[model samples]
Target: MAYLDPRPANPAEALTELLAGNERFVNGTRVHPHQDAEHRAAVATAQRPFAVVFGCSDSRLAAEIIFDRGLGDLFVVRTAGHIVGVEVTASLEYGVTVLGAPLVVVLGHDSCGAIQATHAAMTGTRLPGRELGAIAERVTPSIWQANARQITDYDEVGMIHVRRTVENLTRPGTELGDAVAAGRCDVVGMFYRLADGRVSVLAAESAGE
Candidate 1:
């Protein structure tokens, strides 16, 4: 038997679905969608994930669980601080170009250890090893940006990092950027509130009419 997915076809529709799922999560009335056995078998050979969720590797930032989505609902990519690099960019591009995902979401969270460490590193309090330092370097700009605005909060820095990540993805000349320019997809940055279980949209970049 064949199964069909009712996932959204365009970027705007995909964003709406994600927002609705988040609402269900916040209300604690989550009816987790698309996790049944039949759904699993249907997607074994092919997947039609609607959105590409690029988020942090933090334990609490589970994309499917937090968004109330289930099997084959999202193509997820995660890294510490959700940093961008060649691999990360290539993976996200594959999700949009090859998998036909319409939406790419950059998910960040409050009280993030990465942001905290970056801030501490900038303030001369923490010096991470070479490997971890690379991650800190990627997140350093947001810390600097926050400090420029006299913001001392780590959550504010984390939000800035999220927006920066989305901007990096959609910047001119990149594959994702070209796609967005051509009206093929959208990139959104969001902050997840650890205490409230809510995801707030920070920035959305797409081809404008």
Candidate 2:
């Protein structure tokens, strides 16, 4: 049987599809045989990715594998801790506004080195250069806030960062924000576990919920 395209009219269905894909992956029942040369040729003509992903640059957390999706299925942007910088935001805007992706997932992962580095900096432990320090600086506020709340677990820190990135992207007047408010796109946050390969969504108000 052909797989049903899970591009629902609302974002919730998009998210559900992603979650179900992850479950399939964990259960070792992924269905991506179409990623071969024949499928690649077919997709060469045009692409209609259903979702936009902003995720950490971790090697183990590739969006396609985790979500059990094939080529031309996702527009993905990766950076450390999935931080929302100018270039990243611009890429996501293009995906939402031009590519017509219905959902945007800001994905963080367990034991993220970025979050750990930020925590180290917030605790006044030295990290190397100005370049590395800049990343820590960008993520420090979230770590500090999480720390203040007595939450020290790395998973929680990563989740907090994901939530902050989502909030930053969804603020009013921004292109992503406008897309979300107009119901043209949705921004959701999730956490990926490196050990078990499970994804836990962070936002309570998921699109179409």
Instruction: Compare the candidates by TM-score and give the number of the best one.
Output: 1
**TM-score for all predictions?**
0.94, 0.90
Residues 1-209 of candidate 1 have per-residue lDDT tens digits of: 45466779899999999989999999999998888887888889887789999999999999999999988889999999999999999999999999999999999999899988877787789897889999999998878777787878888778878988988898899999999999999998889999889998885434440
Q: Alpha carbon lDDT of residue 70, candidate 2?
A: 86
Q: For candidate 2, write residues 1-209 as lDDT tens digits.
A: 22234344567778888899999999999987348776677677776678898999999989999999887788999998787678988999998889888899999998899988877776778663688877887898888768777898888878878888888888899999999889998999988888889998886544432
Inter-residue clash pairs, candidate 2: none
Winning model by lDDT: 1
